[model samples]
Target: MKRIGKWKDRLAAYVDGTSGEKLDQGVICRDDQCTLGKWIYGEGLAQTGNLPTFHQVKAKHAEFHVNAGQVVEAVQSGHQDNAHKMLHEGSFAKSSRDV
Candidate 1:
């Protein structure tokens, strides 16, 4: 399996230079699990707030970091087109009921 560290690296690059910033991928906190796809934080998830979908982890170049609020705003912005694409292409929104 791929390590979270590697994933974080990719996420950092994706977020650093892509439209993912306008897509509400959220942040990748120190929690064990992820907030947008799966909450492995041991405690649970970081409540998705008023947003309609989970958070996303992205990267652009160096290393992946967290972009919490921005992602949520993307979901709230009513861009279901991009949201659907991201969700479909990611493990974050695999289930129809997830997002």
Candidate 2:
């Protein structure tokens, strides 16, 4: 969650033209690479795999990564306006909320 907030900060800054943080889409695209993601696919999966909601959470998390990566691409491609929309009201925002 905190990591997501950090991403929000970076993207927000980029949209505002106040920062130039280089986000790695390669890293962002991997759902199992981040801390929360690692847990969700590792110990969390081991313990909660039997629960009906567990898979839902995992799927949402993966979707979040995909959407996040797209936002990163938009930012890196000089499409700040589109990136802002993706970050605020599109699939990226929806996936973040779902996760």
The TM-scores of all predictions, comma-separated, are: 0.24, 0.86
- On lDDT, the leading prediction is 2
Q: For model 2, how does the per-residue alpha-carbon lDDT over 27-59 read when each residue is reduced to its tens digit?
A: 888999988888998999899989989989889
lDDT (CA) per prediction: 0.35, 0.85
What stretches of model 2 exceed 4 Å from their correct place? none
Q: After aligning candidate 2 to the native by TM-score, how far in Å is the CA of 79 from where it should be?
A: 1.4
Sequence-dependent TM-score of model 1: 0.24
lDDT of 1 by residue, 34-89 (tens): 44233423222345433333233222111222322222334567654554454345
Error of 2 at 4 (Å): 2.8
lDDT of 1 at 55: 32
